[model samples]
Target chain A: MSDTPMEAAPFAEKAPDAPVRVLSEGLASWLLVSPLAILLAIFLVIPISVIVTVSFWGYNEWDFYPDFTFENYEYLLTSAVTFDTYVKTFSYVLMAWAFTAAIGFAVAYFLAFHVRSTVWQVALFLVCTVPFWTSNIIRMISWIPFLGRNGLANEVLLQAGLIETPLEFLLFSDFAVVLAFVHLYTLFMVVPIFNSMMRIDRSLIEAARDNGASPFQILTNVILPLSKPGLMIGSIFVVTLVMGDFITVRFMSGSQSASVGRIIQNEIALLQYPAAAASAVVLLITVLIMIAVMLRLVDIRKEL
Target chain B: MDRTETKGVSRRALLKGTAAVGAAAVGSGVIGAPMIWAQNIKDVTLRQFGTGVSNLNEVAEKVKEDLGFTLQMTALDSDSVTQRAATQPKSFDIADIEYWICKKVWGAGNLQAMDVSRIENYDKIVGIFKSGKLTPESTIAQGTAPHSVGFVPEPGARAFADEQTNWMTLIPTIYNADTLGIRPDLIGRPINNWSELLNPEFKGKASILDISAIGIMDMAMVCESMGEIQYGDKGNMTQEEIDKTIAIFIEAKRAGQFRAFWKSFDESVNLMASGEVVIQSMWSPAITAVKSKGIPCVYQPLEEGYRSWGGGLGLSANLSGLELDAAYEYINWYLSGWVGGFLMRQGYYSAVPETSKLFMSENEWGYWFEGKEATEVITNPQGSPMAQVGEVRDGGSFEERMGRVACWNAVMDENKYMVRKWNEFIAA
Candidate 1:
């Protein structure tokens, strides 16, 4: 009752003016937020909702119809290929994550800690980002000459007498897929990790050192905990990107390997939208589960 | 409020407003046909969605100058064209697509049955193309029946379409026989059969196309040669047949018989040019691409025969009135001798050879159509010298090449299963 009277004092003093002022403030905020909200709803939410809705639909060669059927899901569930593809996709995701996290963390750590000058730090960061200025397809194809049987790597190795013949598996193999993924996605890991490491209080490290903690000990105890959010975010990016990537796998692996995304792409190519949607929904759920696990590990929301 | 109203308009704001208004006017001018019609109706632009096989910007400009209507063509790959046809039917007035896509588009109700009377050059379509099947099986009792798979023929047209057919699905445009492109320097032997794709000697040095519909047919030819399976109609495979064919590919893939599975025309070219792959299923244009690089790439004519695919123009169901009329003019112009000659120069054969002949010089006709040795340098689609003097077109004359079409690239009834299996093979 007392709070109510206190809240109403302004209303009582300036009756209509106060309510109108409050209403206009709320309206202005709404106007400010609307553009982003509308864009999100239109582009992101609507497409996802459509995919979810279509996942339950039935389709033939000619048309996709609005009939609730679990047949698409059932077929996916029963298929051995789906299981194999998911396993392969997950393996790629795991392998890409390990390499990206290690490389990204190392690069980020060096820039954040060692590079004292802000200008040098920025220049170094840009150097890391320079590859991104070009189209990714061109960058991916550039690896062909570097890694091909008669490529620079093989030529160098042959000159060194490391092996008699050129390596066949270097170009169109699982190794190439991981190499391309690391090349493309390590930057995704680096930027966030760098940002997180930048935010780490230097005093915390100094204090840990004062407490007789080694540099390794400081990293494990203080820096690691502080950088959890960035790690989680980077992991999410790498995992999701690797899982959803069809092009890199298609090109780098020379279409010798299949990911879940590739199968969905194949279905879309065949105009099997419902099947593609179902596969997409399953992929989305799988990604969500992975994100949930990462979220559990760090609680990125709380950290941010 | 009175002071605000009295204030002079800022030059920046005035200029911005003027620019916005001008842009809106221009945008509306492009979209609104009636606005153009009110001033001048003769210059209607018809929207065309052409497949990558016939990406002729020069021809489109020529058509605009010749015909009153401007031809705005958007080139798309086959899959994108099919997807667009299915989902966005009203996007194009006409789509130039493959014969396989005709049935799918027709079934989806995206394409309209073309009125033969609208096409001025309809009769000029060749007799063999009108028959639909370039190579109908010899035995009617057991082998697949010879049938025209292009636009459903108008009634009284020969064995190509159903005898009583009245609907025309696609107006035949361009076609060619595709074969395996190999590096002669690496292989150092005469390759004559499709079974060479699986030959252990070339293991880890051969690639196949990544397309399921077309790639599966290529593999089916290999299976036939190896005596693994004999398809009644290789174009259309049953579930068991698809499984059998895919199994052969999977087995070969497991044994490292393939260096890669190529997707685009350029990828095939790159694979051959870079010496990453020794032999692979390649398009005719890809062969030209490799050969242009001064590579000793040969588009080998296998004993099993060439895998052929044909494309033609079809009117969109949503098109009508002036747009439809413009579309007809564009189609007629495409069949006109100049465009055919343009396509012929590019390595694609037009439906009407006579029209192409009229546009071509005697040397072009001799080299391209009659399969005689070139007396002079023969140019590719891009007008680059593809063949020097005395160089003969591979597989001899056009008749010799197209006549032995082993199979047409088909979207089989088991397409879904085949796609799934193909993905499995890729993943495996």
Candidate 2:
């Protein structure tokens, strides 16, 4: 202990006087972080501030002007069509998140617990991630061939004599949108959960088994409780992604379904910038509340 | 430590401060270097839609050589182009929009009206361009009055009449006739009319281009020929006439006559090539694609005339002073013989008839440029005329086509309702 204290003394003694050291350290830290701080100021803070400011202004038909009014916000709150878009968006996100999370957890569990070799585990995970490397537009378009009226799925079923007519419900419907959401975002959930699962203690599971605990008991009492943080993290990723997605819903749902993101897109297209900004602000607040609720549930601070 | 070391530190600090200042000066110099070089140049950007046909690169080079001006060109889809025109008016100096879309954007007061007097080539414009009710005063307003002047019409270079080719409001730039493109190998027979699309035998094998106006027009033509409605008038179509047309489409869709709806030109071509669709409503370029592949396909002429649309260039509302003067010069050059000849070779008929005649043979001009016959044979790239045989009528004399103009820049104000109704029809 004395040797250890002596070893640290030279470096400590060479350090500047207390107040000078503190000042120098603070200056060095500021120098290192200044680029990032500038980037955040320009890209994130400034844009968001502008959006908030614009939300309160009135549209002059020809241009956006700096007339302070609550007309945009009032329009959002009063319009039934706009309010319904929010409700529809929330429900779609919830369904999509739940579907992705359920399947993702299962896939992650199989990869972590059942796979015997590291090579096979890595290979399987890579297979799951393969579709993600392609452009999202290409992936969405690939669905057209398989889901068209005279598509491969229908052809297969018809050949097997399973059905006489083509299934119209297969494509350009709510089912297709949800299916695409799950397909695209499941890996986003799985990767985080699998990482957390890899960090779980093997010895604890072995000890539970040695004490004659059943497989179900071990899973319910030991594994699931420990995996809550990962589950919450996965849910956060899926929920936020599904909530903000407009392209997938638009392409898959054809014209029947409307999401909050799509409404924002429509407003922007129509040059209704203030209304779009107000809707965006509302969506941001809603997503923040959701994240806070999720944080409370999982105590993500502990995991961090 | 040593008192000597402590005394030396202040000297080192002075050197480090100088180095830091030098490095920052160099860093900022590197960042600011390109801006200094770019300061002397002024950028004039134009955005248009339709790929492989617009010849934007060639046009840009021509402008640079002739007018001592540089042009930055971007290509986008029709919808995206119109959306950008409405949203970011300052981002583009000129835009090429379809005739129907021109009405919507023009109505929105996003486009500037042209000064016909300044456009030197304005007088040489074919009768179709001159005859329309779209005057400079009507199109060019100071504020939110939808008046736009820079129009370059294409393929369907006819006037808007109650019955035939009523697109007079647009300055026709590039126009292609809409015809039935059929795969001879698959159909094993020649297709001559619109009735074949609804034939029960071709169920799930037939397709139509999913543009609202074109599709609706085709349906109306079919219904008119079938005696489902009176044949002569289309512009003043009653609600009952429109419903009858809608019903034909709905019935066809219910019978699985359509495999899928295509949102792009490429998608439609791909579907045709794969044998997924044997017959479809298509433009000339699509026929060119099938012929290029050596697949036996033909653009069959129906008994009724082809439904067609054209795109024209429009000015922005914000142009003024020197920019406006430059805009007039550009528009004049665009209407000159060179652009007209260029467009003609790309399968588009130009508004400047003399310019078109300069490049095409008298016979070819008679068939296409003059619309002398209802259907005429025109040579493909390989020098063999892709057999385009049908009812040949002079695409009525330029005056007749322009004079009887029926519709100008027709855009449904209730597009949301239209989209919803269209979706319901598709779903059903």
Candidate 3:
């Protein structure tokens, strides 16, 4: 340890301060983030490690034992059901993502620009969240009465002479599953996109207006590119959620559809923990790959 | 609603009794050994968990009244119950579960063999639980029948024995002859056979359970009734049998044969009540729930006979000494009439039907058991009238229904394959 700061300066290389001071600064940063690092290690890493270990273990009808075998993964990778389920799951993710992005962007754009006052924007944003305050299950189940064969939508359509017979496809179909995903998760997209929109410099828009650019040109050229971070974040949220969801598909599609998450859940229900663990590992990788790709597309670090 | 009232009253009574016990323990502390004598009953709290159908809050309250011990009850779905009972042995003291589950759970060694000599109504259990027969003339059903897994050779036995023994795997409690429930007001016809579940007439308005074990059984019922496949044993399907069953259902599913598949009691009720589905697999309580809403539903007796199931209570292997003693006492109280009669009102049979009869009235016994037309309005345990005058129990008397049981719900040896196939059907 050099006692004199001036004497250490010649050998410091790129260091602007004393070596001890630099070490203390790094130590302080580590101290600041250690709690989160420790938490992730304990809650996230340990459980995932156990799951990975269990995935390779053998299982009988009753219990899982510590015998390493790749049978769980082998079956999951080889089976036609697994392939079909992944295809269906990807379709749900695509549909849910597309709809949520479009609707959420429109809503967020309106709130940020057209609302005119921050107070009213906040109040209206709160109004959008009132439906979320009840429950996801209740919201999903409530749709049953509204979209059933003789439900309100059909009855209204009948009275309006919109169609001859009730629409059977409204309630328990792929249409319903996607509808529910949008209903539950559009707010996830809205809040983030709205945040990014609010943070945008107003002078840029004013300058764009001063120019002879069309409103469509201003939206596409100025706003959309700046909102890429928010879009990426919202896409991550929607994609990961849809990928990991089983309940929404189970309830909304009336058990006619299958997803990777549902496969894990079914295995867990049957007490085939090793098989579930295997399926869950596959699902985790799929979701992570999706999130990684989304992250690569846009650096969302600036948005936060 | 009235059941909740009784539960509240009993809870207050229990609090008062606990206070008395505490005061007495303090008073006797001058010459005490931690009041072990007084500590035996009230201090003992047994955690019980099982399927929602049998692990009722009412039963827990009644145990507090009769046994002077706290019975903490948690009710989960059958799959969850099996998962917890097998994996988390220390989490519960007793498991109130189905007999079919016993076959799987027993192998896990989480539950201990119960001493049958301690059961007050051991001899009074129906023959279906003993020799797998309702009568000498009755044939044993082709599933994991109660008798096959009800007993063990010794207290530490790993295997199930068909013979009557001093050690039992579970103390039988509730059972019923299950059949498809139909909307009499909607279907507009007498639905009499199991094959109608696949009939093209109700193509997109039919459903079955999403639970794989029971769903496969129902599929067998449909497949057998349609002469699609002749299974040697529908309960335990071979790989070829499993493949054929899955293929048939997968085709039906692709052709829009199902409106929806249900797992929970409420889902079945909602599917039927909303007319999203007109014919589906349903439970007794679901039919009652529908009828209570002024919807017409019937537990129709098909020409092919009924699919049946039984539920019982078993002690966790971790239970011993005073807690185990209290569990036995609680089980004895359960068999001694009150719970039997309570469950019977909901269209289930008590293990000791004779004792249950003591708790029920002549009219109730006649209506629910004898299948006679109810002379007066018959109410459920909650005291709301469910049946009007001259209405008979669906599927008729105990003998007529239970005697005709085609098979019991079971887990096949090819359960993993069956589950995969079931998932495939859902995907299709």
Candidate 4:
């Protein structure tokens, strides 16, 4: 009777197989999402794979067919033009990033610490964001009227006897390009820093002040340390954006400043897609490495 | 007793169940095959350069109404258009290209052999558009029978009508010879020759297109008229010939003769409008815009004649499959009387001469179409003639412009070098 004790129970149930249930559930969910997955693989994955594969191929001028060759990548690595482009682009991005970050942090800091009312803070932030509503081209063109030889600035300056002749240096120059980049992208930097500042603990600043610290000390010790995540994020945005931009540089730099983007455009125009794709791949790899390094330093996961 | 037996079902049943599931999956794919196939219609996209002239919205609407097809248009520049056509053939269906850009694009095999038979209005096209011995067709295909239709002819602008038919690659859409656009109020004197532009009196007031192709050609014509042998063999010139032409531009730049080097049509118009420039090399559309603003601008015809280019339509390579019939229909409709008339009324001569008669008066047609002498001055919309009698811009039959064209600019080899050099020049 003890050996066959199971016979005593009339309606006893057996334990369910947990793995089978979980697997079945997973299968059902996957079945529901299979269409989207297939679509993504076809449209996104396949095209990107083709681009990456083709980037490795050499081009034939006669048939316009791609042949397998590492020459494109090798040329990019060894060419003086490509190297110079990279160096120039790096410097441009650095300059743009530094300028944007400094200005954005200052504005963000003022709003976060000095501004009291939430409504005014939001209103001021909205003012900064308003220009983002327009197309980049339109915004860039608007600068022409303000910076042209007979533009408002020149007219005013000339009328005020500040200059005898119209300023030719204002419009199609590096200064104008940087000015445009700063005008267009400063918001990208400010929004992130402002968000980060909003998340900073007010009590930390109060504690530093209460412990007989000055405003400078409180800012340097508490505020700056706390805002590193925002600063890094803003710098990354500004750098990546400026690096990839060609139109602004072309319009404002008066064709002298041929950035990497311009070179890619010129190559592509000549029907050199492989060369263009190789250059794009180089840009992508550089950006990825930068992002990886940034993530290692800032632990973006926590900030995000 | 039955529950234990049910729980212990045979493996054969499980095999049957899996087989049924696989069958269902295959069956669904088979049933859905047509839907996927239907979505695979050959879609063609085209890129056209420039903004005001092509007016893609208008073109798209007209195509949709006439041909019952969609033509996606992305407006870009001449350089960008050439680049896309050369690199990404699959990306565009048709390109609105300037006549000069045909060399590079055709040389690169980015263009397909245009089948003239497919186009209904092929027979009615002016004689200049027909292929001669040295056209793009001859260069690209090497003596293969000309297959493409040139809709835009730079009428009366041919440089080498004997050796090569410059009009074969580009069909004439809207063309006006480069006229000496002058402010009569400022100059206070009639300008009858190309030398008037370089007159020291107008120093720092004249402007020219920064592009090397048109500017250099214009200068070559000027030099030729001024008793200089800058252009060899009619208008056909070697690189040395072109270099001499560049010298004039360099001298002008040094002399501060040009108010500004204009890169765009709009910029040129702005220069004239703001009184920053008193005289300049100008296009037809810019003259129209300047006159529309109540400016006393006259397109003065110098003794050397006008330098010009033509723009027209082309078929996409991918158009052969899905929208072949529709594309043909659109092209035919575009060449018909209505569109031609519209273009003519807008001060642009059209490909079809019959359409020009619909909008223009008999006198206007006589002056424009038949190339007959005009009894009266050709006034602007504001009732001002472009120029006084002897100072008229090149006016003649479309065939004349297409036929007598001096040396068509060397766009493939020398043009690329010139464009790059121009960029360098701008940088300098």
RMSD to truth, every model: 8.1, 12.9, 6.9, 14.7
Q: For residues B177-258, write the lDDT of model 1, one tens digit per residue.
A: 8888899999999999998889999999999988877888888888999999988888888889888888888888899898
lDDT of 4 by residue, B349-422 (tens): 67666644665666566665556666566654335554334332344555444333443433523553444444
Per-residue error at A80 for model 4, in Å?
A: 6.3
Candidate 1 accuracy as TM-score: 0.87
Best by DockQ: 3
- For model 3 the local lDDT of residue B71 reads 92
For candidate 1, give the lDDT of residue A107.
96
DockQ of each: 0.53, 0.07, 0.70, 0.10
The full ranking of all candidates by TM-score, starting with the best, is: 3, 1, 2, 4
TM-score of each: 0.87, 0.68, 0.91, 0.66
> Candidate 3, residue A28: CA error in Å?
1.9
TM-score of 2: 0.68
For residue B258, model 4's alpha carbon misses the true position, in angstroms, by: 9.3
lDDT by residue for model 2 over B1-428, one digit each (tens)?
68888878977866655554454344334223211112212334344333345646887776655444466677875656667776778787777777666655554555665545555555566443453332343221111111222232322222222321212233456655556678888888766666777777787677775544455556655666566677334533445555566677787776666755565677668678766678877767776677767776667666555555557776677766656555655666666555676566445668666655665666556555555652446664336654356523323333333332222333443443333334335444
Please write out the lDDT profile of model 3 over residues B262-335, one tens digit for every residue. Answer: 99989999999988898889899999999999989999999989999999999999998899887887787788
Compose the digit string of candidate 2's lDDT tens values, residues A219-288: 8898888888888888999889888888887677543456778767756654568778988898888899
Q: lDDT by residue for model 3 over A4-42, one digit each (tens)? A: 568766678676565455557567679879999999999
**Candidate 3, residue B87: CA error in Å?**
0.8
lDDT of 1 at B29: 40
